[model samples]
Target chain A: MSHAVHSPARPSVSTQTPALEVHGLGKTFHIGGLFSSQAVRALHRVDLTIGRGEIVALVGESGSGKSTLARCVARLEKPSEGAILLDGIDVLKRDRFQASRTFRSQLQMVFQDPFGSLNAAHRIEHFLRRSLTIHGKGGTGQGSEAQTRRRLEELMTTVGLQADMLDSYPHELSGGQRQRVAIARALAVEPQVILADEPTSMLDVSVRIGVLNLMRKLRDEQGISMLYITHDLASARYLADRTAVMFAGEIVEEGESLDLLANPAHPYTQLLVSAVPDPARAGSYDPVHRARLRQAVMASTACAFEDDPHQRCSSEEPVRHQVGDPRNGHWVRCHLYRPGAGAGGHALATEPLPEPQPAA
Target chain B: MTVSQTSFGSHEPVLDVKNLTVKYIGDTRSTTAVDNVSFSIGAGEVFGLAGESGCGKSTIANSIMRLLKDPANVAAGSISFGGKDVLAMSQDELRRFRWQDVAMVFQSAMNSLNPVLTIGEQVADIFTTHAGYSRKESLRRAAQLLELVRIDPARLKSYPHQLSGGMRQRAVIAMAVALKPSLLILDEPTTALDVVVQQEIMAQIKDLQRELGFSVLFITHDMSLMVELSHRMAVMYGGRIVETAKAHDIYTTPRHPYTQALMGAFPPLTGPRVPLTGLPEGVKFHNIPDLAEVAPGHFVAPFDADAEAGVLEGAAQ
Candidate 1:
């Protein structure tokens, strides 16, 4: 692909360890009282890796467990199972009860709601200074105050905000400006990895691109890895180097962002790609077809492609199958891609499905 | 007015707004939220009003519904629905006109719904209040409305929290169309919904519109969704319409600098990846001149020579 040539900021393949690596990450929530508690599986064996300077986008609907995965990685929620490796070191095993200061400094998280994340009482500078002091970056000496001031200004500049805004409260700034301040606070600790969960979803459409660009700039210049969790496929395609599509608490498809979206292997991913509003494409909204597809997707417990006769997709869990070139890192968790499923299944997996027809 | 006449030449206009201005007055200062905005929705057409927050899209919707509270007053304008002046309606007449002639679906369906009551009770309340139907008849009609929006009639007894976000929105839509209103104003109806659910809701709205034949004032910040659903659209910026045209024409060739910047904000899913700077830093197209008909049905606010040169330079990158 010409992405290498066009995107000079793309990190080359290096022998250095990945910034974040998640293996068999799973989370299950217990609901109701102790008499008869119900176990709800929020995540299931999610395996992901983000290289230094790479942005991997996790895309899914509200209940698809994308946020849960991010929470697990950020240590907000303790994963039920699996290991989390930060810079090839297993931090989960080391710090069982609480996240160590090193782990906190190395991995920071930016939440969705900028309005709710920041304290209303504190000024923008207070948040950044707190992060710096908590991480031991801000010193107590006389010259240290100037050093901290310079660092705060640098952080503000990195996130494309003016130093004068440091005095403003959360309520005084606009949604976009508040989000930039949030990013600056995350950057205050000089994190190696940042888990951004729907960072720009709450911001205005015109301002969303600015935040996405800032994220890319951070990855390119600082070599910081990022896990961008969002439901918007178009934004993920624009910002992420790779995309992993989650469906019903599982990764349905994973590959290079453009390649996966352009040639979606999983039925769920196909549905998502088709559902995204594309102005260029002719309007295709068949209510009946959409209803049937929604029903099928919701009804399936193990796999989305439950109609596949060769494989029992409704009951049996689908395994990951490589699609196209192995080096492309394109794969799908679908029964259709299973080995020896049949010629028909193989053809279905290879050729993309036709777009839904517009209403008559 | 000429632009409306050209666009709605075949179909009759359901809602006509002319020189509409809404201002929020403070003790010492007054700020215009909707500044001399004008547009008309043809019968059975989806007319989209798109802009960022605080651009006065919602203010226009509120003015049309006469739901503006204290401090927010209609400064100047005439809003006519089927040749009847909306601003001149009496309180009693306005109450009847609201649900019987026009209905609105707010941004958040969850907030719109009464959490303490069942879906059936909420839907039935509209019919009982406006249509003067008996409780039994209204309940039956509520079940039918639920079915129309693809929600199970059994869920009629369920609370708003029991249903998903998409279903909650559908329930709201079902309620809005219960009285068979001539106009339905949806203010960011599916903004809180997921992509798939949003598509489904849009499709459902399209199907309902086709069946019932009601004009829609679909307001949202998402231009892609707006283009997909709207027949004609007006792009708002700084309390003024910057561009107005057919959905296809606006998508293909946007003339206004704000419209162009908005179009560039959306990155394509299946195209060459390029970094797009959405809006230039600190660039505001404020206090623009009136819209001039650039094409047959296309209307664009003509920027002055100095501002035009600057905006073009800023947006062109």
Candidate 2:
């Protein structure tokens, strides 16, 4: 494969500061009027980082607050707490009222639905050209017209689309093609970081890989950092360098993609991995057991592991415990991995912790 | 295991679709949505039809339920359920045939439910209208149906919005199976659901089919779920059934290029990662030949020169 030779080594963590670092990020939504509003914590002290030219996947089920984190990072929502460091600078503290033009140019967001993201009334070129003009990359003058046309063709080619597609309306393009146009528009601003929220979820199975490959190509060629958010674990494993599993608005597990998925530490992450339909696996899902796990996970605000003997799981929040090789950056937030807990300590942590059996 | 337990193909199929052709008649030109496609489901069997969007899998499901409207017309075909001609049914017969003999669960069926009405009222409506039961008796039976799907009978009083996405979908399934239909057509039933919820729903569907003895015509684009659930499966592309075989055979040794490509689309979670370029760009398999029995019980469509060339080029890249 072409990418086999071109596949760069996984970016080293300590050598350079990350392109984007989110520390103790939190978001809470209030329902009803101010007088009698109910506070819903959509995000809880979330911390994640995307190294330069690296891809980090934020995976979770629906309403797990994965999308909420992305919205907060993109400055679409006001975060209740924590810092968003872009290139070692805290953008949240600097941009108190609104996101400045520099912050906007440095960070771009690609939404899930390609059909809804693109305007049906405008041509593909119109969207791309508008982004370029807004970012001061292109203009309407006669001399700049030629330059803009060249840049437009370059964007189309980089996304692996024919230049002729620029003249076509958004409706005429396939779902995959529309997604490529969306990515090209994001790239028009030459942003250093991109946050894609379920980008390939809407495309057909066959065409989905094309878009994924395009994202990988962009990361390799342009050295742009990205946060790929999706509910599909297989795709996350296939594309992301690092994977973070989210549950009930909290980061439950974070590690190298292959290591985390192959040996999930958190009980919720284990249930998620086992739930994915893998033709290679022999046994089928047990609906009764799944129902019990689902109920336990949703009903409890503390640890999802119901079998934990330690009362700390129910009474207090679990902290991040280093598991497996420390250099691999694999960690989990579960009471089972507490320092003095029977299951605590590394080396033997390559396998999953003890299975959690919900009470009858 | 489910497929091996049942003695399929020896008995008359519960649902037999033969030479089915459906077209959408537009003003400029008519487009064939489903072209000369044929498949069958035995009693208590699960038959999966998989393809990308606009591949006519859903169109086939819609035609079976007689839900096609206006521009969508049945161009040519014959649909027979239990040796009775479905296309020849009168308005009254059609009404009786639907839900009584054959039921359907559309994509995102959870949202199809009315928010204002309670789940009990909705499920009981089926019994009162179809089985001619009293309102009290229907409500009692509705509670039983909810219990069968493992939802609390007390939830029968709750509105659709009150339940979670998974519970609402189970409620929809309970209503579909209330009439004890012989065949159930499920079109992308778990598309909008999360993986865990999707697995739970599928497992429940499998259990229900076992207990109730009903055949299933499952339609979806996800191949992994199809293999996990279906007994016999068919792969469709561009309005054509390119391959049909037992689920195991389709997963192990898929003959059709399109089927093989579809299998390669999903990346493995385990194993050394490889750069897999999913279905080649702009390569549509046109002029597909009819399915031939290449092996005993396995059928595959012979690829034309154009398709073979396209697939080869894609593989080379």
Candidate 3:
């Protein structure tokens, strides 16, 4: 909705491998008493990819499993079943120490809470130096010392923090400053892919925009790929090149951010877009007239739209229906958009059940 | 209903606060959380407070409720609601004043709901303690309150875990309005809910306010949500009210650079998209800018008048 995160055409993308790829991701959490095991399906065959220098936002609500997906990609929580390839390396398959270090360093994450993720005991210098040392970019040799110091200053300046802040502890800095330190730490490794889970969600409005702009500037200047996850669609639209609307652990829609926002095909996406409190429409919002929430059905055999129960929706899960041009196409998952699917089901799906005709 | 409710002339304000200041006393250093903040809410008005974390919006809300935690004290201020002095009230009067006169609905306040108690029991408990109602009568009133919030009255038998997040929030709102308190202070009420659910809850609050004639003090970091839901708003920065104006003007023609930045912070749902920029590099809250009024009922705190004049003029058009 704001600045363009996508730059002009680079070297042909088809020739280069994707920066990060996740295939058939499934995460199951076993809860309840030990005697009575219960499987809570957080992710269901979810697949996501990030090309070189691309930012893909995973948008969803509290229980929509977006956080779980991010955690899985970060390898903080091992996936129940899936394969993750970071910079063409099998992230899930490799062992923790030596073999995986190279690939693991290719990815880093910025968490939601700047306070919780950062250690209060450490100064800005500690975090910056620690990240560099872990990635083998630190040391005190004639060549390495000067290079490391230059890198530290560059990282701080890139995030818009003053070099004087390097000596200050996390508690002394403001929320935005602390977050800048976090971003600096993420960039210390010069990671190809940065997984930001609600990075600005905890920040104030003015500070949030500053952080968003910094993120965009980083991607534009350094060409770092990012996975931006958030619950706010507007912020996501502002920052992401491509937007994926996730509901109940499945992508309901994915497309160019602006196009998807302008013409949301999925009922859930439409509801989300419409729910955005329009300042222009102040004092006249009609929440009652909007699309209501529908129960989720992640079962592939059945359509995800539980309210609009059609024969096809019940019998088979609706796959992505291509809309618009292929290069910048809009894709939605709903039975109503399927070819030859008549207007025979619930009106909620944009296909109203046939109204009875009066005698002419 | 837009007219202030005071005496026969109907010119006095409903909830009038003046120079409300709060400070958190640490062992070594005492930090001022809220300083010289002043505003008022009309009989049927919605006054909004917009600011970031530690900016003292919540501290002001808590101080108004006399719910300040230990180590935090309301240093100076006068909070009078419908002619009753809030600061001077006795402990018993404060207890009665809390729910019966002014009630608060907080961010994720639904979590405060007792897990062991039924939704109906929680509402009934409020009645029994606050209004001294019988068990049966309170349950009856509780059901009506649930219905008021568009929730099924039958769900009153369910526990906190049984209800959805939105439902639990609505239930908390229902409890806040159970006595039809004259004023309801909602501090980031729907920040935790989904955007759609948030819209629904705000709509419910608006409808209830319209029907019950209770003033609302709404606070959030969201400029768009604040503009739509509030009649008038105050923008707080570094524990001070940096700007104040009509909700419409706050969006369409904000005078303050901070307010302008706040409006730009949220990407417009509709309208020509502009790159979110113009907040100068390395600007934080500590720098106190002078708040000035260039027009009637509009206050501003520009970063620097000469430098930001271009933005102010642009926003005006």
Candidate 4:
């Protein structure tokens, strides 16, 4: 990795109320025929929190439920069961108009694709002014039009864009520039919490860090709490304070960014970390070797259940138990962590079975 | 540059570009899309072109394929490929050479597949256009091409939407290589997929190239992935080649300041902890430095000759 996104050392998490809190979140979609319904559980009692000014990352593969979680928090999709508290306000309980207006100011999102998210016909200034006008922060009195234009210029500058760019339509800008415009539009409202889902994936490599650095700056200067959702672990390690490794709608592990990356506790997390294409490794992609690796990874699956363990753990059905140093805030849910658990072992509370040998 | 392939006694590159510039004539004034850029790709080697958005990476790719149309116009320079200049080729010749000699896989081109058509039909379309093969023969060759990409022949009948994203990408790549084209141009081939899928696609591309002895002009923003795949990589900035070197030197010790800043900007999955730093303010490629050859094979563009020479001495070891 030639260029990387980094920040100055941040202070450790304090004992203050979280900026955003989610508890026992669950979302289900009905599939198949109406009468013969099949419940596809998108989220399964997931729990997480974002400390003030901390960038918490939710890392998961596609179809692993990261987007679902983001949508739930954004209240774009209502959760079937769970509570999301943003600045002590129950986001779900608020009336439609009140929530829409408040959400515009307090919570905002930058989407995955800049091309799809931004309108092709509108100039950059149109997007900048809409958020301000719609959210009732369109500036007051004394040639407010000039004031709005000035603010638009400032927003563009913060995102490393020139003032002349305001006249350009979305299609006229590059992927990175368009993304910067999207971010500037989000910031026009001065949102307290930002949810960025794969913001840099669609952009060219050279300009990706420019966007990431902007988010870090927002976190440091404005104290905006961000929920960065992505499939890339390197980005998660770089931009997050706390990393939550999600698989099959459950957080297999959560801890300090460096700690989790340096020493991953879960099998899935370890595979992900190892799978990174390290340039240092010569002949890394030998055809037979990669095929073997793929086969091995696919062979591994979630351990099946024998009996229920507890209300939340058993009622909801856990692949394993959460065991680790709760004091250090490092949590791991896998057979490796359970007491008396070994390779391929079940959770500690469950009936014992013969342990399998460590995987080669 | 090492110029390992240059020993064949050809003073000219297999592909030579000189003072190449492109502009897009929009509704307003013509925008200089690609400045006076110059670079070349040799035979049987992967030449990576790395840059960010608006850095004119894609413009270079499109120009090489003769795919740029409408608003885009090549203002200057020449592109010589396979002993014939590409810019000078007639529409009919360009079309003939497109798949038979120089094929291109666009950024997310796999996603552009016709959803209604089966994977077999897509591969057959290429064969039909280039070789005028019969349907039965094309189907047989399609199954073989699918096998080459590690996908089962049974999937040839599946629609584009039915196959997984990875499979769809493989099908597109398979089509590009159906005729064993001399050069394959991949523009951000795996940007949309997950890491695992990205690796899978890259590995397939690499294996196929090695087996077929076809050259690749790989373009991406991911330096790590580029390093892993390419034999040599060129860093482009403001429509110019800032640095070019063997993949090893480019990764371990980059010569250019822009390359250095870029290395510092990306996040690594497994490596020593380097505190992530933000892009510096008011930094411009032309304003800050000049590019110079620091090592035997690596060249870095710095603002001035003195600074370039100074950095070169430090990098000599």
Candidate 5:
């Protein structure tokens, strides 16, 4: 079950200063109306931090609390527990005025449904104009009307949209263009962090790479932090520096993007990574591989994986244990990774996964 | 796999679509959705139509099924199923042909399945209506169909809402295959499901195709799935078939710039980092040159673009 994490010595950049920190976040939804007592745990005590100008991808299957976590951070839904601290300030603990004004100004959310989210009756200019006017933050660029116009043009240019597109309605633009407009709107506020939830899932496959490049540019050039949430792992590996795998309502594994994808420790993560239909890795996704994945447990009350040894998965809780060698700070939340209690700490983390055989 | 065997020397294909052009007839302007597309699905062959949205991949599939309504019609095309002219079929003949001859599994499983009806009832309904079987016999067949998709036969009595997303998709597949259709048209069939479930569904589709020997017209924007599943694939762009070749050839050694871009658009999960940057927005592939045989079995469209444009400008090279 051990898959060796492979990557050359990464350029060690100082990740001392944190941009955003989330501690023990959780959200639960009540099933019925106010009358019923049944509740579903959508998110559990999730903890992670985004470094300055870093892109951390939150990957999972549907109903895996990925969207729920992004929503909680975006403040679309109130977190039932935990704190969302931006620059050491607990945004959730702030007052209503602070939450809307001070909290919202620093963080922006780029939605998946770009066309549906924007008003069909308004032009593209209206969307950006309203955002810059409302949350531009004094002296940050949009000081006067003329400055606002220039800033809007700059935002449009940054996102690879034309100046004439500002006059066009949302419906007039193609699906890809509307998405670029949505991304431009997120950048207009000069936010320090962007919570993009499946922004390119609805766009064309040809244009999806363009948007991902734009996102990478945003992180590298603008020095903006991001929590890119999606079900697609391939895209994440392309755009993100680090990745956190979520299952049900918990973060099962997290590490450097290439390391995590090349060597997924958690069973669910392994299944997802292997499930990607790579022509090069065709042997790994054959019928026998599919059968192994389909028979995996769904919505288990115990630990998420079926490969939990020591039986502590069903009896007790699983905590995140740091992986050794090649994966400096990589963590996996499985009983197998537990030290001394199991087969020892990262004892089997040596063998490199079977390389793809040349296509027959 | 058997489809390639038939394509090697056979003259009569399972599904033959020639010069299929679909257009939206507006009052002022008419825009082509699918134009001059030609392809054939050999017996037991999983032929794929690979393209991005609005490239008219779905339009071609719908034209084959005769499911296009007003505003969207087959402007010029010839569809033949095993030597029978589908375009010349009468309204009654079309009704009898659909589902019995070719079954369509739509993009959304929830929208495809009848929410009000139970799984067993829906599967039985298809059998009774098409095959004219008795209720008891139809249901007995329904249970067997449901089991084919690996769904619990006991859950056949459960509603569509009762099943999970993956289960609902399996139920829809079970229902589509109830009459043992010769061809299956799947448009992004497993796009909504997660990767793990998608693998399961794909495995089932392949298993069923091998057992039943049905030709599949698999339409999706996912190039990786095309590479892994299809025996032969046609790359579509700007409503035209840009390239056609063996699936492996198309993935590994694409000739057309559009085909290369489409393949490069999908990032490999585990490989050397190869960033994909597509063609410029101003590049028009509408007036591409005639399809030329680049290799023995591979066909590619010639281009008249300069060095600064098309596949030359991006990471596809």
Candidate 6:
């Protein structure tokens, strides 16, 4: 078992500022009667931060709060607790004007289903034109309409689309084309950070890589910090620099993408890694073993062992511990990495985590 | 592995779809969803159709079942199941032939189950409609079908929403195979499911196919799963089968450039992360001109240099 000392929380490294900092984010949904019997806690004290120019992946199965976390970052859904700080400003605390102004070119989101996200009634040029006009990015020259058209063509070319697609409606285009259009639209705003929630899952497997490669190109050229949310570890590994594995609304494990993937510290991470189909090792495990492992993992409660009594397992809340060098930014939240004993130094120095922003 | 168990049972093909073409008709130009697709399923064989989305895998499936709605024309080809031409049959005849001889389990088909009805009644409905069985007989058969699919017979009373995704899928499988159809068409059957659930569903389906001696035309986009489950596989590209070969050969040495790209396209978890690759730099769509047989029982669609050059020119323009 990979082991390290347990540290519940640690302060952000002083020199390295986070592009987006989130602390103690929470969301709850109430259902049923006045004396409501059911209150679903979707997110509980979720804390995550994406450093500048870094692509942090939020990965999990459906309902694991990966999408919820993405929505929270995008402010598409309001969080019940905690702060969302984008580039040193608390977005959740600022006024509408201040928030919009700051976040206008700062943050933007790309949805999963390109077809569903795009307006079917509008032509491709209409969307690109609106985005460019709204952001005041297009040229202010003679024959400006022509210039805008040229700019739209340029954007289309950049996204692996053709000039003819400008007049084409969403319905006329295939899924990959629509996604390319969506990416072009996102690029129109020139945002510093892009939050893509399963952006390629709905696309064909053959076209999925093309979109992912485009995103990587954009990230490198534009220096745009991206939060790529996906359930597939392979895709996440291909694109993301760091990956935070979320399970039932908590960041159960997080680390450098390759390290965490190759040496998954958490049980949940191991289960996810094992779940990925590797053609090399087909039929290694029988149906019985697969079923047993799946059942055991699913039945395990979300509450860390310490929090709930019935939890025969130790702490359900991971004992946040560093696996590799902090400089490398590898952190895991599992008992397997109990600080100070297993792999590295026994007593890791504790510092206060980033402070929560004041409420609006 | 189980293919041999029923190989000698019948020389007759379970399903032979010849030159099948489906076009969604409209006021102007109709949209061709499937074009000149020809394939046959031997008795107890799992004939896999692997393709990306919009490649017409499901269209062929829908056409085979005669479940096409209005404005949808079956322009050409014949779907012969158990020696009966399906496309040539009238609506009345098709209805009688549907569940009794040919069953289809669509992608996310578990959702097709009625949330209001118990699993038993839904499955029993198949028997009552197709076999004209009494309620008592249908219920007993439903329980037995559930057993065959590896689900507890007690789940017959459970609503569709009450079961796990795997169980719900099993329930759907139970319903499909309730009448023991000679041929089963599964269209991306486990697409919506996770890998573990997907594997379990595949295993259960394989077990049932082996025991009951039914041929399965398993359709999915995932190549690895196809290799694991399929006896013979066909790769579809832009409404055409670009390649058809034994599953082992397709994996070991894929002949088509499209197949080569597809096999190398996916980044597996355990493997070293290779930068995601695609068709040539500017290829818009996945359409190969013609499939050529490279070996006995193995066919591959070669990359058309002219077509590739044309696509590049279009991109340039």
Highest-lDDT candidate:
2
- TM per candidate: 0.90, 0.89, 0.83, 0.79, 0.86, 0.81
Model 6 alpha-carbon miss at residue A304, Å: 16
Deviation in Å, model 6, residue A176 alpha carbon: 1.2
Estimate the TM-score for candidate 1.
Answer: 0.90
Off by over 4 Å in 2: A1-15, A32-34, A139-142, A287-317, A336-360, B1-10, B304-312, B315-317
Q: How big is the positional error of residue A38 in model 2, measured in Å on the Cα after superposition?
A: 2.7
Local lDDT at A70 for model 1: 89
What is the lDDT of every predicted structure here? Answer: 0.82, 0.83, 0.77, 0.74, 0.76, 0.74
Question: What is model 6's DockQ versus the real complex?
Answer: 0.34
C-alpha positional error of residue B123 in candidate 5 after TM-score superposition, expressed in Å = 2.8
Question: If both were scored by TM-score, which would come out higher, candidate 2 or candidate 6?
Answer: 2
Candidate 3 lDDT tens digits, B61-162 = 888898989899988889987877888989998988888778899888989899999999999999888789999999999999998887778888999998
Docking class for model 1 is: medium
- Residue B121 of model 3: what lDDT? 91
Error of 4 at A258 (Å): 1.0
lDDT (tens digit, per residue) of candidate 2 on A1-360: 112112133344333667899999988787669796666677878899888888999998777789999999999999999999998899999999889989989999999999999989999999999999989988666799899999999999999889999999999989999999999999999888999999998888878888988999998887778999998999999999889998767787999898899888776777788889987784656545544544434333445444445423433455566668876698888633321122111111112324433211
Interface RMSD of each: 6.1, 6.8, 5.1, 7.1, 6.8, 9.2
User: Per-residue alpha-carbon lDDT of model 4 for A214-264, expressed as tens digits?
Assistant: 888888777778999988888888878888987656677788777788877
CA RMSD of all predictions: 6.3, 6.1, 6.8, 7.9, 7.7, 8.8
lDDT of 5 at A360: 14
A1-360: candidate 6 lDDT, tens digit per residue: 021211122234232557789999987667678997666666767888877667889987666677888887787777888988886778888843234644766788889899798888899999999988987778777888888888999899888888998999999988888998988998887776789988888887767888988888777666677899987788898888889987666777888788889887665676667666665666654655544433333433342333544323344334566666676577666442221111110000011113222111
TM-score of chain A, model number 1: 0.84
Docking class of 4: acceptable
Chain B TM-score in each of the candidates:
0.93, 0.94, 0.90, 0.88, 0.92, 0.89
Give the poorly placed runs of model 6, Cα more than 4 Å off: A1-15, A95-101, A133-154, A291-317, A324-328, A335-360, B1-8, B19-36, B68-78, B90-92, B115-120, B136-170, B280-293, B301-317
What DockQ results do all the predictions give, each relative to the true complex?
0.55, 0.53, 0.46, 0.30, 0.49, 0.34
Residue runs of model 4 more than 4 Å from their true location after superposition? A1-15, A32-39, A88-90, A93-100, A120-129, A137-177, A188-190, A285-328, A335-360, B1-40, B70-80, B84-92, B270-295, B299-317
Alpha-carbon error at A267 in model 4, in Å? 2.7
Best by DockQ: 1
lDDT of 2 by residue, B1-317 (tens): 12223434458788889999999999999999999998988988999999888889988988888889989999998999887898888899899889988999999899999999999999999999999999999999999999887787888899999887877888999899898888899999988777777877888898899888889999998898999999999999889999999998999999887898888888887877688888875646777778999998899988774758576566535
Backbone clashes under 3 angstroms, per model:
0, 0, 0, 23, 0, 15
Candidate 6 C-alpha error for residue A156, in Å: 3.1
In the order shown, the chain A TM-scores of the predictions are 0.84, 0.84, 0.82, 0.79, 0.81, 0.79
